[model samples]
Structures are given as C-alpha cells and as structure tokens.
Target: MRIPGPEPRADGGVGAVAAAGGLHRYQLWLHAEYGPVVRFQLPGAETAVSVADPVLLEATAHIDKRPERLFEFLAPLCEAGNLQVLPTAEHTPWRRLLLSVLAGRPSHERHFGQFAALATDLADRWAGQGDREPVALQKDLTTLSLRMIGAYALGGDAADPDKVVTAFEEVLTEHLGRLYQVPVPGTEEERARRAAQALAHLRATVDRVIAAHRSGGRTDRSDLIGALVEAGERPARIRDTVMITMLAAHHTTGVAVSWTLHLLGRHPEVAERVAGELDRVLGERPVPDYADLRRLPYLDMVVKEAMRLYPPGPYGARETTEALVLGDYEVPAGTVIFYPFWAVHMNPDHWPDPEKFVPERFLPEEVAKRPRLAYIPFGIGPRSCEGAGLAMVEAELVLAVLLKRFRFRPAPGHEVTPIERFVLWAADDIHMLVSPRVA
Candidate 1:
C-alpha cells in the first residue's frame, strides 16, 4: 500500500520545511496531515519515509545504519570515518565500548564531583549576576555542559577546559554554519581556516591524552580515552571517538537543562514542585551528589517532559538494509526511514493533550502504559546515544543545582523561540530572570 504525504514541490521540500518554520514543525505538520507513516521529500535524501508512531518504530529499530548523505555534514569531524555512518561491522564494537564507559555507573560516579562543581560554578556566576540581569540559559548552560563533558572526556587536568570549549565551539560554529548557511562572521576562506585550526588543536589535544595513557599503561574503565586506548583503538579512531563523544554530549545535555528551565520559568508551580523535591531530598545543600539523583524522581520527570516538548535532537534517520512492513505500508530495501522523535512524543493517541506540559505523564504507572519508543529523547535501538545515561545524570544534577538555588522567571519582553539546528536550539537563547531562592 502507498504511504501518504504532501505533494512534491520543485524546491525539493526546502520551501515546505521553511514555510512551516523548521524541520521539527514540518514533521508535526506532515504527520498530522498524512498519518503515522508518510513518504516525503527530504532535501538530501530525496524521498524519505517518516514514522511517528512508536509501535511502528519497532520495525526500524534493528536497522543499524544511518543514511550517509544525511550525516555527511559530520564527516569532517573525524579522521578515521564519520562515527555516525560507520559500517555496522565496525559500529557494533564501537557502540559496545562506548556503552561500557558512557553507560557505566562507576564512570558517572567518578565524574560526579567534577560535574557538580561545574554546575555549582555556573550557579555562582548566575547568582553574581543579580536578579535584574537576565541569564542566557542556552549560552551559559551549554558552556557549562561543554566544560563538564570536557572534564569527563579529557580528564580534569589533561587540557585547558576553556581552550577545549572555545576550540570545539569554533569548529562546530564553522561547520554547522556552512551546512545551514547561517552567515557566520568571516569570509568562507577565513571561517574554513579557523575551523581547520580548531580541529587540529582539538585532535592534537586528544593525541596528548592518548600519549599519556600509553606511557602510563592506564586501562581505567571509567576513563573514555583510556578505555579506547586499552581497547587497541588507533589514535585516529580515539581522536574521532573523543570528538564525537564531546560533540554529542556538549549541546544535548546543556539544552536539556536550559529547556527544562525555560519550561519551569513559564510554569512556576511546576518549578516550585521541583524545588520542593530538591529541598526534601537535599535539605540545605545546594548541589546533588551522584546518589542524590535517584532520590529526585520529580526532577527526572520534569526533565523528561521537557525533552518530550523540545527534544534536543528533534529528528533522527536510519537506512533500511531490507524490505520492511510499517503498519499498512511496506518500505523497500535501502529506504530512508525518518524518526520524528518530537512528533512521536506528541502523538495524540499516546500523549493526550499533547501540547500541555504535565510532568506527571512520566509517573511510573503512566509511563508503563505507553509504547517504549513514545518518549525517545535519546532515541531508539542499536544506534541510540550511548551517552544517554550520562546525559541524564548531568542534566538532572544541573537542574537540581540551579532550581535549588534560583527562581527562574521569563525575562521580561524577551521571546523564546525553538529552531532546529545541530540540536533543537533556542533561536534567540532562552533568557530568564534568575533570583536566589529563600529557605
């Protein structure tokens, strides 16, 4: 049977996507008009099938490969190969190794102190800003996340955190700007040179860390670089792995926290509930310990709901290796299967009053009623983020600290808008009036 979608346009879906604001909104419109499975034109992929139903997603879950053309933008980040599009044979082991460290409790515990310190420092800075100054949640929080991941990925003392953050931002800004045609400051040649230099610096920094690991004969399971080196991954692959890990970790967690705060700012009652949970859990303590995280289930619920509303990475794509059946439709071999995560989270059948912000939707009994893929902020299947576990820990901790210390209200007269970028980003940054909370 034929999958439904909008009529083809000469601009190859660009006009439609832009007309609807961005790809995330475009996906929502497509699914609303065409049902769960829609075959549509995706600029690079030409014709793609998007599945917004969680039950339908199971069929595509095992399809491990991502469409290469869609991910070619990330190719320049790696010297070995773009980690996103690596062959399944190579990707399987890599995913296993990443999961071992990124998904491990010991790694998270080892990094908890550093992550808390970073979060506390950001809170301190925000506190110093005083209530009158509106904090740029996206800017400061993403920077804090970058620092946290830097400390985690490259040991706390391996490289200058500020330099690493600056260099990575330079590399990302240049590459993503070029891809989106965002009109960055310098001429094309200048931007390219800056990106190349930043990439070289980042690669060299990873090499230094690798050299130290080799010389010391370290094989720490909690250490990302050490684990990769101990696994006998070559220097280039190690560099690529670090680059990709940092890249993936940096923005997603930051924005998760920022968006949560953005939601809390607009919903003060929910913010108060989150604050009450933190107070009951930690008393007067400002930041949460690693163990304290599991105690604050409400904060976790809030973060999950926030991600459901504004997923950090709004959409994901996979390439089918064989023919498959999705509900009433049959997709051919080598088809581009789009996972509209944001839309899936908004599916009315699963999420009643899908537009409303209600943290209770994530209550244990409530969550048990929905399909597994319905709330996939991290994504689904084999290619899902290995950093999911870590990202959650980091986000919850940051939210715990910031909410425990401050009352965030929307900055007066400032409008917050969500636009699709490398991640779902606040186009103008989420500005909030952050004032200290009284005991």
Candidate 2:
C-alpha cells in the first residue's frame, strides 16, 4: 500500500513545519491524520517516510546508515568526517571503541566524583541566587552539562573547563542558529569567523589532551582520550571523536535534567514523590554517589517519564541501504526513514493517557507490557547514542542533587514552550523558583 501524508507543499515542507510549530508537532499531526507510517516532505531529504509504530521500527533498526544530507549541518564539527553519517565499515569499529569507554561502569565510577562536584557547584550557585530570582534552567543546566562532559571527555586538568565550555557554545550557537534560521548576534561573515575560530580552539584543546595522554603513557580504559590513543586512532580521528563526544553529551544531558525539573515543577505531587525517594535513599547527604543512583528507582522513573514527555533529541533519521518492509509498506533502497521519537512515546496504544506525568508508567511491570521501542528517548538500534548510559547517569545525578536540596516551582508569568533545536529547548528557557527544602 502507498504510505499516507499531507499533500506536497510548494515551499518544500518548511512552511508546513513552521505552521505546525515545529517538526515535533508536525510529526504528531501527520501521524494523527494518517496512520503510524506517513510519507512527507522533509526539507533536506526531499521525500521521507516516518514510522511511529514501535514494532514497525524494528524492521529498520538494523539499517546502520544515516541520511548524510539531513545531518550535514553537523559536518563542520568533525575533522575526520561527520561521525553521525560515517559509513558502516568505519563506523562499526569507531562505535565499538566509544562504547567501551562511555558505556562502562568503571568510567562512570571514576568520573562520578567530578560530576557530583560540578552538579553541587551549580546547586550552590543557584542556592545563592535566592528564591526571589528565577533560574534559567536550560542555560545554567546546559552549561553545567558542558562542564561535566568536558571533564569527562578531556580529563580534569587537560583543558580550561570554562574556555572549552565557552568555545563549544560559540560554535553550537552559530551552526544551530544557521540551521534553524534563528537570528544569532553579529553579521553572517562575523558569525562564521567566530564559529571557525571557536571550532579551531576546541580542536586544539582536544589535540593538547591527546598529546598529554601520549606523553604521560597512561592507557587507562576509564580515560576517553587515553583509550582512543591506545586503540591506535589517528590524531585527526581522536580529535574528531572527542569533539563528537562532547557535542553529543553536552546539550542532551543538560536538557534532560532541565526538562525533568520543568516537568517536576509543574507536577508537585510527582516532584514530592521524587523528593521523598531522594530523601529516603540519601538521607543527610546533599548528593548521590554512583551507588545511590540504582537505589533511587522512583527518581529514575521520574527522569524517564520526563524524557518521554520532552525528549532531549526529539527525532532521528536513518537511510535505507536495501529494500525494507515496514508493516504493509515496502520502502525502496535509499529511502529516508524518519524516527519520530516523540510520536512513538505518545502512542496511546502502549501508553495510557500518554500526555500525563505519571512516573508509575515506568514501573517495571508497566514497561514490560509495551514494545521495546515504545519508550526510546535515547533512540533505537545500531546507531543509537553510545552515551545513553552515561547520559542517564549524569541526568539522574543532577536531578538527585537539585531535587534533594530544593523544591522548584514555575516562575509566575513565565511561559515554558518547547521548540526543536539541536535538542528540545524551551523557546524562552525554563525559569523556575528554586527554594531550599526544610530538613
């Protein structure tokens, strides 16, 4: 059967996407009007097929290639290649190497102390802000995430953490702003120059870290650059890997924690449950250790539920290398397969009242009832984020720290609106009044 979607628009799909608020909302509209699978015009890819059914997604899960054009926006960030769209032959091994470091418990344990200190610092700063001033959760939390990831990827003393954070933000603001057509400060030429310079500084920072690894003769698996060097990765590739790792980890983790706070602020009862869990799990403690994470299941559930509602990276895309059948639809080779993650999470068939903020939905028993892909905030299949485990660790730790110390309420008169950027960002930023909790 031919897939269903809206009529082709004259301006390729940009106008429709804008009309629907953003791509996330547009996907929801398309799926609701059509069915689980819809054919639509995606600006860069031209014609693309979006699959919202979790079960249907399994057919395309093994396809390892990403559509190069769609992800070309990120090409400037890498020197070896755009890591996102690397060919399978090169990507498979690269992915395996990254997973070895990023997905391991040893690495997380080694970095836990640093991550906790960074999070606690942010909380302390927020504490000093006083309850009268609202904190910009997205801005502040994303900065915190950049610091954590910088420390994780480049090591504690390898680079100036503040400089790395500033450079990365400069580069990201320029590229993402251009892609979204959001007006960034400065002229086009000036913005491009600034982005190029920032990108160079970041690359040099990675190079310096790599040099330190080689000179120190340290080959610990827990160390990202060290592992890459030990694995015999070339300087360019190693630099690219660090750049990509930082790029991937930076905004996503911060937004995950920020969005969680945004949800918890609006849902005090749920927030109370999360706070209760934190208190019971880490009584008399200000922050959670690595061991304390697993024990705080309710907090984990709250983070998961919040991710389902406002996924950090709301959507992903893959390209078909061969003919594939998604349910009744047989898509030809080279087809663009869009994964509308938000739509899948909101699919009412699996999630009852999918819009509600109910952490119990993630209770072990409830999750077992749904398809595996039904709750994919990270993504699905081979090309899914290698940093999933670490992202969860970082997000949960930050949430545990903040939720344990304070109660967050939405700032009066401020609106929280979700807009699709590199990640799901609040259009005006999530402003919340954070007051300390009474012991």
Candidate 3:
C-alpha cells in the first residue's frame, strides 16, 4: 500500500536499516514522532519494500480476515510452517482451537507453581555460588525456561534436560541466524545442500524425541506435543506446529528471563523490591503455583517493563496481498510491512522515561494511562503469541524464587550490550556475579 512520499531524495542516500539511526533512535520515532515509517531496503537484495508504521499495525491473527501474509524475512524459521506463519487454510482452525488449552484459568494456575519452584531452585543454586563466581546468565536462564516448558507446561521428560536443551538450542540458533539474512548469500547449490542437511537434522532430532514418547508414553505430564498428537487433525502440520511452538516457547522466554535477571542484578533496588514482594506473598513457601502468580504483581510488572525495554522477538513483518494504500503513500503488493517492536517499546511517548528499569510503570494505574496496543510484550491481537501465558508464568515464578534466595550484582568491568542477532541477545553474554543472601 502507498503512504506519504518517503522516496529517495536526490541530495542523499537512505541508510541501510541496520545503520538507520539504530534502535535507540527508532524508539524516539515510535514515541515522539509517532510515524516516520521510514523506507528501509535490505542491502544487496530486492526482498520486498518494508514499512514501519503503527497506524497500519492491524492485528492479522484472524483466519478469515487475514491481515496480510507473513513476509519472507522470517523465512527458514517461518519455514517450519508453524501456525504463526501458516497461510490461511484448513490448519487455521488448529491455531484457533489450540488457544483453549493456552487460555482458561487453571492452566495458568497449574503453571505458576511450576515456574516458582524452578525459579527457587535456580536462586538457591545462585545463592550458593558465591559473589565472585561467574554465572553465565543467558545459558542458565535459557536452560531453565526451556526445561520448564518441555517438562511442565508442554510435558517432555525432564530427565535428560541437558541433551534436549542442547539439541533445541542448536536447531533454534542455526535456523534463526540464517533466517535473519536476505536471500541465502551462499552459492545456490551449496545453500540448498546446507538447508537440506539442517532441516533433516532438525526433523530427525524432533522425531526421535517423538518416537521415545510414543514408545514409553506419558507418566503424568503432557507437553504441547502430546496435545498435538492427541488432537490429531492434520498430523504432519500439527507436528510441525508443535515443533515451532517449542522453538518459540523455548528461546524467547529464555532471552526474556535472562534480560530480566541482568536488569534486576544491575539495578539492586528493583531486586530488593522484588524480594520484598516475595516475602509478603510467598512467606516461607518453597515455590509458587498458578494461584500465587496473581499475588506477585511487582514481578509481573518487572517482566512487562523488561519486555518493553527488550522484546523477545524484537520485530515481525507481513506482506501485502495486493496493492493498497498506507497513509499518504500508494504501495504495491509484496511490500513487507516491518514492525520494530524493540523500537516501539522504548518510545518515550508510549513509555515515560523509556530507558529506565521501572517495573512500576506496569502497575494498574500506570497501564491504564496507555493505549491497549501500547504495551505489547507477547505482541498484540489474536495472532499474537500463543505461549504468552506460559512465558509469563515461567518468568514470574523464576524471578520470585530467585529474588527470595539471592542478590545479584553486575560484575564490574563487564560491559553488557544488546546485540541484534536473529533475536536480541546480550552481546557480552550477560555475566552476573552471584552472592548468597544472609538470611
């Protein structure tokens, strides 16, 4: 669709998206300017015309009303043909129907306790690890989050957590890195070979896990995969759908949880406040349950703030089905509409003092001040994240349990910077010095 004329000016060339003032400046545009909707062309390829307008940010999750097609920029990762990226088809119902499990009150309650317990275990480990020790924050958080999803929510065996974690991590990062780039830069034949090999590896690993479950079957817990198999509509599609959820539910939560930990450690007052909340709600309890999650409002707010500051999957894009208009500019079909969430979350207009770590901003009164779509962590609308509830429960419990047991201080001389990978990651590898609490 066309919008205002953001055509190339004669006097100067438009900078590439990576260098286009970066996320720091884009955040300003999202809040203060509202809609610069700058035209960004990925270097060396004619993938599609990209837009960054929030006005046109319609929620496209509805199967019948399909907003637009998921753009190819998310390819390879989108290659799994997961429900998130699936074209509107018979499988569309799967995405909708699956929501019942993710929704409903008790599922949320069931998960909160699991999350709190895991968080406590993690904190206890951290508390015992001495202040001077180097705790690889990302690895720890990612492992814990993934395990929680696989074992508790999605119900995979927690017995071999490390093996599953490694396989999951590898498959995710490998595909994610490739998907981030435009047109596989390597030679065609070579690229094809690599792609085949990677997909085969991923499918095989996932299949083996599936087979193991089939042979042995569930003891007491059921994972998302189990739900998919039991549902049994489109077997192939359903399997792929569950796999994609695993990948999404896997790393995104980990990155978010890690970011929260680093932020809390760096800002001790926030940690202290989080600890105080735990004291009032948790008392001497070993862990929290789904019921206890609601009581930890401060922890919830902290995660909400963390997500705004640093989104798990920073952006998403959709392709226009046919030529249409966006604002003042006339656009053609195939244009990729890019929504830079990281940029939007940091906008001061939407969020006061955007850069600060202020969980209090998520308090009911503070949240009431903003628009509905303004504070999207799991994203906005129906097609938003299916695992949002699962992610939140996992995070809150982890934060609460950890805060109750230990205090983390940022290691001196360690510069933690966010590097834009397929997903935003702590470039310096988020190292937090661990120390046991006196109590």
Candidate 4:
C-alpha cells in the first residue's frame, strides 16, 4: 500500500514497521496494495498479516486466541482480557446476551450520580485554580474517567482508584513501547515476574470483594458489584467478567475522551459551537447525564470528527477460521489478519477535506450519504463495541461539561502526536491552557 509522503510501507516481506500517525494517512495504503488484506510483522514475535477486509475481519475477531494475541501487546494487566481483549467466542456471548450492566438494572442510564459527580468535581477544582494556566486537559479528563469507571465497576469507594490507574498505565505503556524493539529474554522474564505479582494483588482484590458480597454484605445498593455478585450462580465467571469489563471500559474511554479534548482545543470554532449548543441544551450551571446527551447534537458531531481524525484504535485484526481469499490475497489459519483503523478512517473517497477538522459534516443528511463501514469509530458488525452506547453518553456528557466551563488551546508548543495500536493516544502530551469562557 502506498501513502504519499515518507511514511513506512508494509515491508511486503517481513519485519516491516510503520510509524504512528493518524489513520487517514494510512488509508491510502490499505486501499491500494492490500485493498482489504495486509501483512505486518513487528520487530519481535511471529510474522503477522493485516486486513481491512470487513468480512475477513469478522472471522478474525471471532478467533479464540485472537484476543489473547492482541492482549500480549497490552500490559499483562489486561492479559486477563477486558471485553475488548477477550477471545471473541467467550467475550461476545457474555457481552451480547449474558452481561447486562449496560442493558440491565442500574444501567448506565441510571448512573447519573456517578457521571455528574465526576464532572462537578472537575469544574469545582478547575474553577478555583485562579490563573489561566495550561492544563493537560487530556490527562485530567483521563483521570476523571478512570475514577468514574472504577466507581461503576466496584463500589463508589473502589480501592485506591489512582493506584489502579497508575499500575494499568505503567503496564500498558511499557508493553506498547516494547513493540517497536526486540524483546529480550531477560526483559520478558522480568515482565512476567511483575505481572505475576500484579496478578496476585488483583486476585486478592477480587477475592475480597467476592467474599464481602457473598457474606451478606449489602449497602442497600445495586451497583456494578451487586449485579455481578448475583450473576446467575456462576460467581467465578461473573466476578472475572466484572474485573475484565472495568479494564476494558476504563482506559479506552479515557483515551478517547482525551483525543476529543485535543480536537476541540485545536479547532476553536468547533469548540465554540459545541459550547453554544451546550448552553441551548442545558442552561445555567448545567450538569451532564444520560438524558442531556441526546440534546448534544454539536458535541456528538465533534466526537465523530475527532474519532475520524484520531481514532483510539486505528487497527483491529482476526485469524482465519479456514482458508480465505480476498482481493487476491490469501491467508490460512494462524495468520494474524489486521485491519488498521487508521487506514479506513481516512479514505479520500469517504472523507472530503479529510485532513481538516470539521464536525458538521457528520450531520444526519451528510452521514446518510457515506457507505456502510466507511465510518467505523466504534466499528461495525457483530464485534462492534458493546459499550458504544455508554461511550457515546460518556463522551457527550464530558464534552458538554468541559466546553461549557473553559476555553482551551494547545499549549505554546505541544503537539498531539498519536500512538497507533489498540487505542490512539497523544505520543507526547496534550497540554492546553483553560481560560474561563467569559463570552
């Protein structure tokens, strides 16, 4: 695949690597050479294949070991698998039918207290800071999402929320960075040893919650823990599933929110428009909740544009169940077929002025013109994100709260470089100065 400029090509053979960039730049390549199927082999491990071929992607995502291999790129913190990283067969069924935190009692809809508390806390703190100092809006927002997700997963007073996030990021960053380099045997051993220690701690943490809930511990509550505690007699799977769910929902949401903030900061006009809409939808001292998100049409558009520009996950892959042929590319079982999110998000045919930051184009009339699968921020088909509903609410709500309160801009020289993998992130930092929107 050919992307005009100096970006790396798909090594065609093996050991070819590409630099981290927005998916739009990579879309040209995916459609050109690979059309739908592509190959990539990181610095270490086995040779792998990648594909944006939607049909083939479905089968790959369904592979039992697919999630596990993907997780290896993640810190072992998620090795246990979050909803996103779990093997397709195991995760899909439970996520689709069995588990119902999103579609069940105390659904995200019923969780206003948690989301509001987070937004309020952020406003109160930032409001009092006095000076218009540049804040890493992304960093602050990520912290908020992590804590809120913890509250949802465990109880309101989930154990050491900061510690949980710190450990998770350490493992995630460490593992992702290691991908660009060779894995030393000694380093692998060290990571496993650390992972074992973390696993022991995590198991202990899960055990305590299980023990408490099983032993008639009741807070007159029916939060995430309570639902899982009574997950239909299969206590172990339920508990494991809860732990994994938090892992999936927490960090992914945080990174996505961070990117949104960066996009709004960079595009001041869009930021102003979103703020104006927030005012219309929610008047003085407005707080975000499930109900308010629907009224946030501008905020929703902004989010879609951000996801289009800087997708949290630019690529997703799966393994073949049997021999498959697509666009003249053939692959057998055990081949890692990849579908780069970065590739699909930026096809010129699909996106006009693809490099520019424009949100209104996502309006219903315009969106209806795009082909199916052309815009897949949350992905498509069976393997699409189960938490998309929750994510949409979370994003719109956070954007509403933030845009209403501050006028943010990129720091003097901060560049929002992104890392391409399971999620996209600012490679350096998203530093922004937040001035009161005194308009």
Q: What's the residue-level lDDT of 298 in candidate 2?
A: 90
User: Model 2 over residues 1-439: C-alpha lDDT tens digits?
Assistant: 8888888988999999999999999999999999999999999999999999999998988989999999888888878889899999999999999999999999999999999999999999999989999999999999999999999999775547898899988998998898998889899999999999999998898888888889999999989999999999999998888888888989999999999998889899999988888888888999888999999999888889999999999999999999999888889999999999999999998888989989999899998999989988888888999999999999999999998899999999998889998898999999999999985
Each model's TM-score, in the order given? 0.99, 0.98, 0.80, 0.81
Candidate lDDT scores, in order, read: 0.92, 0.92, 0.62, 0.63
Question: Candidate 4 — which residues are off by over 4 angstroms?
Answer: 1-15, 18-36, 40-49, 53-68, 73-89, 97-99, 103-106, 157-160, 166-199, 217-223, 232-239, 327-334
10 residues in a row with least lDDT, candidate 2 = 155-164
- TM-score of candidate 3 against the unseen true structure: 0.80
Off by over 4 Å in 2: none
Per-residue lDDT, model 3, residue 17, is 39
Residue 381 lDDT in candidate 4: 54
- Model 3 spans with C-alpha error above 4 angstroms: 1-15, 20-34, 42-84, 106-117, 152-154, 179-223, 322-333
- Provide the RMSD of all predictions against the true structure, rounded to 1 decimal: 0.9, 1.0, 4.9, 4.8
Ranked candidates, highest lDDT first:
1, 2, 4, 3
State how far residue 36 of model 3 sits from its true place (Å): 3.8
Which of 2 and 3 is ahead in lDDT?
2
